[model samples]
Target: MTATVRPGLADEDLARLRARVTGPVLDPSTPTYDEVRRVWNGAVDKHPAVIVRCAEAPDVVEAIRFARRTGLPVAVRGGGHSIPGFSAIDGGLLIDLQPMKTIDVDPDQRLVTVGAGVVWAELDRATQEHGLAVTGGEVSDTGIAGLTLGGGFGWLKRTCGLACDNLLAAEVVTADGRVVGASDTENPDLLWALRGGGGNFGIVTRFTYRLHPVGPILYGGALVHPAQRTADALRFLREHASRVPDETSLMAALVVAPPAPEFPAALHGHPVVVLGAAYHGGLAEGEHALGFLREFAPPAVDLLGPIPYVALQQMVDAFTPRGLHYYVKSEWLADLPDGVVDALVDHHLARTSPLHQILLHQMGGAVSRVAPEKTAFTYRDAAFVVTVAGCWQPGDARGPHVEWARSAWRACLPGSAGGAYINHLDADEGANRIRAAYGAATYDRLIAVKAVWDPDNVFCGNHNIPPGHSGTRQR
Candidate 1:
């Protein structure tokens, strides 16, 4: 099992690797290789030399060992939805975790344990059955691994804290192909690193989360207005965000209405500003906390109502379906001033791409309450996290869409807190942006963790935090 890592692949070594793993090992020649390699991002078209559909941590350990022996770059795919396409690799080894879909819920303990491959929807469905949930990605299809590892946000974020915040423990296969458990009682520093440190130190095979009571239904919905009202909506969100209860999540978006039967045909293919709100507290308080959206000049479309928490999490699924060509840039802004609002309206909102949109997630409450140094997810206390996402079909020209997204992101950067969300970073944003995601101290600490668990950086495919020697191990 221990082969000296070299920078070339050997057929005999590959054969030995295949013989050691329990999962299905696939090469490019395999009939289903193409299908197996496909990821959720249409923009990604990587073809890893070997694809290991890991069924468990042992399978992962073998794959990592083989890849390290061959010195082949490695990529890990959980839900297969890395916006920056880190879930795949070109001519390397792909550790596809999708086959590890084991999930268990302990209702009495208020906890849920899942394999890395589990997506938000699958986990949400299981947890909802037990009347417990955690803060997950807004789009249900997003993989739990990538989201939680990079500071997950969603409707529950403001009230219940981030997905990383709920993390209790994890079982990961370190770079050296050793199985390790990370929790307060064991390898606690690794647990802290896994909370929001990206996939730097190791590959997580299983996760344990502390769940909160989230019943079947919640008060939440969206209010849509004309695109011309972008500024008005932005201003309203800016003012309204500060006073909203910790149990409430108020967010906004500027997007083109999809031509679905549920929406007015006349409004289809056009831009609009959407104000979406959710409350996990009392119904009466929820009404009072979110009624401001309706009073802002009767919306063109009002879909606000009492809806199931699971259903509410899926409201964004339509616009963010699998395989959509997407490019994203984000910023953490303390407040949405007039200049920022104008920048969005004049530069981004004026243009319309069917699925492209600007999203503003109002942040505070439980998320900000956690000290910046509590976890590797140091980007905190920002009034809002704004994202400019350009989405289009695969056949369309990617240039214009990418450029448009970049332009909008740049316009908002000047008003930002000089940092980006680790999860939202585009591949091209480079190291500086990654550093900005976690300020100096936090980033340094993360690097130290990486040094301990993954000294040679075998898992460098994600928003990587390379192993370092300067800082002492936090444990």
Candidate 2:
């Protein structure tokens, strides 16, 4: 209850929020107000006195009724890749939703309804033009609605699962501004808190997945290794990422080497480890579940085979772009112990920046077959999830890369499988790691569905879910 950032709005509240938002109402004297309040993490330099570039769902219900008639503070930008700078907010009223571009494919019921500024490379190039696909975002311009409402997984997450387990319907905008519709028979507890329950309890804008038949080509790629065999490539990718096959998805990262002339100018600034396979199915069962990448060792560059599932979802789009300066710290392991590969090779060889990296992902098949109450992303037996990515670029000093990703995730939090990964946390890990990313009966049924749809918490900026009572967890 401490807003105080109103040195700007009120010329009849910007003429009644520009006569109820038709899109583009920005402030700080508009003229494109710093390019619609820049977002994709340049370590987020915010200044939101009001932005509102929303366009549909009645421009996010009149920008949540003009952020509750000017008490302001509300943020929500879809493809603005919110890595902790909760999509931009300083004295707030963001609601950008990147100009709500719509998508909508159907290909004889594979289904695909986008918009919420659809991103995962435009919903994997409009669901791969009917070859169809879904569990998206391994970076292809992330933001398939904040990675499927904060619980997405990539490379077909063990063959089709987490993207909030193929959502199916949404279109929120609640905090009293009304306009609802979640699915599986409408408002099923707001489709179980928009599947993964981030963005608190509203402002979804549109999303309705449930597609599949992946790859118009698969048996995927990458197998790197070199930084002095990165702990034997993380003990050969934690013993073949538990013997592959959920149509093989495996990941493993660790990175550094980017001097990009397609790499290997004697492994540029060193440290490698790559390992990225991706199978969806049959190339002789994805080459016998990736023949343990032809038995490990001797891999300076392997580049596996077949490709296109939209070129492996735009394969790390030139090693992550959008104004770089992302800080992550992730967890959830349930395995991969070699003191977590010597704490991720002693923090990527004690590096400070060669654009730092770590990402490990390879959780269980079909993401542990879904059922921890079927939604609100209950980790589902995490088998590996590591992150630690504290990249650094714009004028550096993000306090020594957020203290090197919090001292290498506190040396791998006693091999935690306790929590973390509400989209790789990191807005200062509050609310006790968001109640260890949903525990205690799915955070007390998302605090009674955020007290019946944002009981005045008014979508308290991303990663907050307060609305009191039921087993109580207010902060």
Question: Evaluated with lDDT, which candidate comes out highest?
Answer: 1
lDDT of each: 0.86, 0.81
- lDDT tens digits, residue span 320-406, model 2: 788888898888878777886887788898879878888887889888988878798877798888888888889878888889888
**Candidate 2 lowest-lDDT run of ten:** 1-10
Candidate achieving the largest TM-score: 1
lDDT of 1 by residue, 304-420 (tens): 878899999999888888888989999998778788899898765556366788999999899989876667888678989999998888899989888888888888876687698
197 Cα displacement, candidate 2 (Å) = 29
Task: Report the C-alpha displacement of residue 318, candidate 2, in angstroms.
Answer: 22
Q: What CA RMSD would you report for each candidate?
A: 3.3, 19.1
In order of appearance, the predictions have TM-scores of: 0.95, 0.36
